[model samples]
Target chain A: QQQVKQSPQSLIVQKGGISIINCAYENTAFDYFPWYQQFPGKGPALLIAIRPDVSEKKEGRFTISFNKSAKQFSLHIMDSQPGDSATYFCAAITGNQFYFGTGTSLTVIP
Target chain B: SQTIHQWPATLVQPVGSPLSLECTVEGTSNPNLYWYRQAAGRGLQLLFYSVGIGQISSEVPQNLSASRPQDRQFILSSKKLLLSDSGFYLCAWSMLAGFYNEQFFGPGTRLTVL
Candidate 1:
């Protein structure tokens, strides 16, 4: 069973435009939600993370809007740049284990 | 400051061959270590995890096996490689502080089995 589900397997946006990716989880036990960005031939890096207590968290141009009641969270990138073109993964953690969503590939067209 | 290392960035092996991938963490002790496999353009699948030396937990059953001989060393081994085993292998480590910790990932190793 997939504990976390992500939508839009791929995305494309023009430079300076807004890019969004969303994820949903069924496990209420999940308390920590983190987003990771991965470039080709490299390891995924920790982009931003949010705890369930917060409704939203923003870091620079990246923002994570989390809805506790809906069991959903979304990543928003403002002023998307070509350098931001990569794969994004949303993960949820419960206890010591993590459940990941099947990544979303984003392309920022310059 | 902590860093993770994975060896043999790339590997190509014939079917039925033996395989081994190594991962190590530096600048930290008693970390929670994990192994994951990602297929081409796919999500990561958790393979194994360990919280201490000689303690390994397997999430999936297959030809693959993992061992933690040292506090910071984790090894993935397969007695006989299969074509289905071709994928990118990743090693991650997180502090044993609690559940709120974020995992640090290594560069990963790409394995191709013919």
Candidate 2:
């Protein structure tokens, strides 16, 4: 069973526009939520993370909007650029194990 | 600073061949190690994890097995490779056994089972 569900298996956005990807989790015990960005032939790197205590956390142009009551979190990329095109994954960590959502492939057209 | 290393950036092996993939971490002691496999068009799948030396916990029932032969060293080995085992393998390490929750990943190894 997939503990976390992510919507819009793939996304396409124009440059200078906003790109949003959302995820929902069923595990209440999951406390830490993180987003990872992965490109072809490379490891997934940490992009942004947020805890349930905070409603939102932003780093530069990337923002994570978390809804604790709804058990959902979303990533919003501002001024989307072609370089930002990559696979974004939402993960929930419980104990030492991490449960990952399927993944969303984002494409920013130039 | 911590560094995680995974060798043989890419491998091509025929079916029924033995396989070995190695991962090591530097500058950390007794880290929680993990092995994850990513198949085509699929999310990362946890295969095994270890909290200490000589300890391993398998998350899935498969032809692969993991071992922590020494501290900071984790190995994934298969007695005989299966075509379904072909995928991108990643190694990750966290500070402790439980939820202190940041995992640093290695560059990853791509294995092709022909």
Candidate 3:
């Protein structure tokens, strides 16, 4: 069974526009949510993460909005740039294991 | 700073050939280790994890197996590789169960079973 679900397998956004990716989880035990960005031929790098205690967390151009009741979270990228084109993955940690949602491929067109 | 290493950035092997992939971590001890595989255009799949030396927990039952002979070394092996085993492999390490601990991954290794 897929524990975490992500929407929009692929997305294209204009440069300087907002790029958003949403994800949902079924397990309420999850306490930590993290997003990872991976470029072609490169390992995934942690982007931004949010704990359930906070409703929102922002860092520079990246922000993570979380809803604990709905078990949903989203990543919003402000001023999207062409260099931001990459695959994004959202993962949740319950206990010691992490479960990842299906990835989203985002392309910021200049 | 902590770093992870995986050998043979890319490999192409014939079917039925034995395979071995190695991963090691530096600047840390008694870390929780993990092995993950990703297919083209797919999400990462957890394959194996080890919390300490000689302790391994497998997430999937496949032709592959994993071993941790030392505190910082993890190995993935297969007696006879299958064509479907082609994918990118990643190794990660995290501080043992604690608050706000995050995993750090290696450069990754790409293996193609021909």
Candidate 4:
């Protein structure tokens, strides 16, 4: 299958709280996984990415926890702020094709 | 830096109208190109991809088609658009130099069919 399913269509977090979003894919051929962050009326920007060879990768306050055995990955935000409110997307790439998750809208209330 | 662009930020068409959307990339040569469509609050759906000039592989079959005439130009066209052919169109590109496949997206085009 080429589907990358994401969970929690929407989430609400408070200031200084951690926000988590999950995604799972069926195609095992995928080796590159990347998460994207998008603001209102703008294109999605690359956030953080990880390879299946590693279980986790962190960039500043954003981290990707990847599980090879479960064919799943997740994005975790540390000490989320109100400006972090936006839609996030997870994508799986094979060679030239990419499969994307449904996306998650996150809101951080101050 | 590299940038991807899509034309006519927004469009509205009738059901029987023909459609054409343009996408171009700057600062990159021989990059892999892609076309995607997204519904309101939904994820991006891959429509087609091109590896080189005149080479196109479609992932979904609907009332749409794609073409790559030059190295950095990709176009999405339909002879006759249907009511369901309206959505947010995005163009993206990634370097084919190696295994790195992080795609960069464009501002996106909103199409409304009435």
Model 1: DockQ score: 0.79
Highest lDDT against the true fold, candidate: 1
- What would the per-residue lDDT of candidate 1 be over residues B9-41, giving only the tens digit for each residue? 999999999999999999999999999999999
Superior candidate under DockQ, 3 versus 4: 4
The residue-by-residue lDDT of candidate 3 on A1-110, one tens digit each, is 88889978999999999999999998888889999999977788889899999999999999999999999999999999999999999999877778888999999999
Q: How many backbone clashes does candidate 3 have?
A: 0
Candidate 3: tens digits of C-alpha lDDT, residues B1-114: 788999879999999999999999999889899999999988899999999999999999999999999999999999999999999999988884678666778888999999
Off by over 4 Å in 2: B97-100
lDDT of 4 by residue, B1-114 (tens): 888999979999999999999999999899999999988887888899999999999989898999999999999999999988888999999985676779999999999999
Clashing pairs in 4: none
Q: Which 10-residue window of candidate 2 chain B scores lowest in summed lDDT?
A: B95-104
Q: Candidate 3, after superposition: displacement of residue B75 in Å? A: 0.6
- The residue ranges of model 3 lying beyond 4 angstroms of the native Cα positions read none
User: Between which residue pairs do clashes occur in model 1?
Assistant: none
The deviation in Å at residue B37 for candidate 2 is 0.7
**Docking quality (DockQ) for each candidate:** 0.79, 0.74, 0.70, 0.79
In candidate 1, what are the lDDT values of residues A8-54, reduced to their tens digit? 89999999999999999988999899999999888889999999999
Name the lDDT value of residue A61 in candidate 4: 96
How does model 2 score on DockQ?
A: 0.74
After superposition, the stretches of candidate 4 with alpha carbons farther than 4 Å from their true spots are none
